[model samples]
Target: MAPCVTEWVTSCTNLILSATALHSSYRLFKDHRAPSVGLFLLGLSAALCIVHPSGSYLTSIQKEAEWAGEVLAPALVSFDFLWLSEDHNTAHILLCGSCLLLGLCDWLSADALTVMTRCLGLSSLSCCLTVCLFAGNALGALSGVALSLPLLVAPKVGAITFAPLISPAAAEGLVKWLLKGSMAVGCWASTRALSMFLLDVTDRCNMGI
Candidate 1:
């Protein structure tokens, strides 16, 4: 797809904070089990999004990434603060609750391979079908093979809060690395979800959902 500078730059900036956050979270992963839990959490979160009334927490996430961007993913645990559309009470609680679970799962799935391996079929299916909801899955799943590079290369400048990728001065020291990772991973998926939601289809393929 031809890239839009605004969207591209925004996506890149989001990458920086996410990479930093993942790097920090890795430290907390003791042994292999932590990663296992992380994957489970991610899987669970995805499942919840699929089953919930308003397609899970995708709405809250959509606004967060569009506005909050990077911090939205790294601070996955704090997804409670994500944006809202048309005032949804069930979605709000479910969104926060679901994000909390997904955070724990991601902490367990340390590597993308784990999720990729399990979701391989879905990933391929996502590519074949242009399900409006899974729109991002096409390139997203393919990119899963090398997710880290983008994480490192995406811009870190003009970055706002929790954007650890930005050269934060002592003033911005408040935002830690873990927060960046949480926002990155969470927001990334959230954006993808929003894409699917906006398109309004739940078929397996689009962004490799």
Candidate 2:
């Protein structure tokens, strides 16, 4: 498939996945009583779905809109992870802080900042992943990896496929789209899996099952 078409298809898929996840999460978690945490989850899901990268394909101001999904969405997820954590240790704060800083640096177009953004973005993912694993939410850790790996990988893939080799732009674009789709999946899957796991534990406790 052509690069443009592939990008379109990937974007569409992410939109559907994110929208579905948001709807499903609302239905599953509403009225669960943990209002603060629930709102954070729903809010993050909604933000990812609404500010999705697909908008860039349709909007005239593509570059500006792209940041919402590329940077803001994952940053919000990192914040949500920290907020949901039972303990706010220094490491967790630093990790989440790195994720937030990456988002801030994302807006700058400096060549020097590009490397910083990539390193910090990857580190942010690790931060979230560690936080989730420490909290015993394996699904959340998986989400962090799926959604953020592309940030670092896309550039290298682009470099490898540059010029006559294979159109670096296409390879990079494809990786980015996959990243967006993974964000959708991560947002939905982590929340859904965690909710179901908690419910199961609660049920077993009550029923002695």
Candidate 3:
């Protein structure tokens, strides 16, 4: 298949998977008495996953590097001013702060999901799957955010400031690889979580529990 076709296929698949996961998560929340804050965090995490760029179109547009850069420049500038800066220390501080914030989110999500699973009296497999899903989502979100900073934070400035750095193409390739890894982790987690949840539901129905 053509590259564009392949990219579209992948993007569609991701969208479907993310949607399914989000639905399952919402249902779980509805069935349990989770903290309001937990619900908000999980909802936000799911939203981020849904809205994050897939870069599928890059395959076609990368051919016009200059044009792509021109189109992306304004957005990049805004991202830098808002989240990154020329000062090395400031950039590091921002990156660390973002990571810390997301880390807290991940911890809260995992704890909430764990509590819900236990409250439901799910089997060990079901509990494990839920935890795996949380871990996967957390890792994926964090990694995606980390990869995005370097890509968007004053690419030209970073190139000059950080000596012995890789070329732009190399950096882009690295980011793409990391992005794929994150997606893989998410896919694995979501599939397991959904399967286990369904299985639990079936068991409950059969046993009238």
Candidate 4:
């Protein structure tokens, strides 16, 4: 059967957002050799597959591959920060390690992994936002917010169980598509937001201002 209007819209949105994010990540990678950013790019690349029109029919192996990227992207970002931080206090190191462990343990359970990754990603974004706010960089903060806000709704979109106007099966299908789209938005926004913040910091350091 042909895709309905909703599927078309959702797939288009996901494709656009994921592609934009992938571009931002590529530009950042060109300038910096940070493993975290590279991992995020990998994740975004995997995300492109999930947002495709036939995403709903992904094979089990394909789904697992996508989930692996999702789980590692945020953890790697935190790990990168820890590696770069001047003051690697015990608390900070321990926290990052703990989160990485959680992602590893949650790996087999897709739903649990999604929630964990989002929380980890949000924490990383929040740290970036705090730094941007302290530096009075309105644009960086805006990007961070753009990245974080959609994530707050993503879990809820997946959890949606009913729509009075539609049958339960249709509602479930709609929710799944919406969830994929939301995840694509999260991938795009997170990479762009994080990369912008890092770029701004790099500029300030280089200028010594």
Top TM-score model? 2
For model 4, how does the per-residue alpha-carbon lDDT over 1-209 read when each residue is reduced to its tens digit?
A: 13476566555655665565566566556543443363455446455554544445555545555555544444444444433333256326535643564558535476765566667657655654555566565654554444444334454543464656665555655655555555445445545555665666678779995
Regions of model 4 farther than 4 Å from truth: 1-7, 35-58, 68-103, 106-115, 148-162, 165-209
TM-score per model over all chains = 0.21, 0.60, 0.27, 0.57
Query: Which stretch of 10 consecutive residues in model 3 shows the poorest summed lDDT?
Result: 69-78
What's the residue-level lDDT of 82 in candidate 3? 23
Provide the overall lDDT of each model, using Cα atoms, as 2-decimal numbers.
0.34, 0.55, 0.35, 0.52
RMSD of 4: 5.3
- lDDT value, candidate 1, whole model: 0.34
Counting clashing residue pairs in each candidate, in order, gives 34, 0, 0, 0
Top lDDT model: 2
How well is each residue in 3-121 modelled by candidate 3, as lDDT tens digits? 56545554554455345434434544443222112223333333343333558574333323322222222122122222211234433443343334334434557555334323222
Candidate 1 lDDT over 1-209, as tens digits, reads 12354334444444564343344335323422222233333333332322224644775654323322221222232221122122245335434533444355435554552343234323322322333223434433322222222223223422556345444442232232333334445434433433433343334346565
**lDDT ranking from best to worst?**
2, 4, 3, 1
What are the per-model C-alpha RMSD values against the true structure? 18.0, 6.0, 16.9, 5.3
Supply the global lDDT for candidate 4.
Answer: 0.52
lDDT of 3 at 109: 72
Query: Which of the predicted structures, 1 or 4, would earn the higher lDDT when compared with the native?
Result: 4
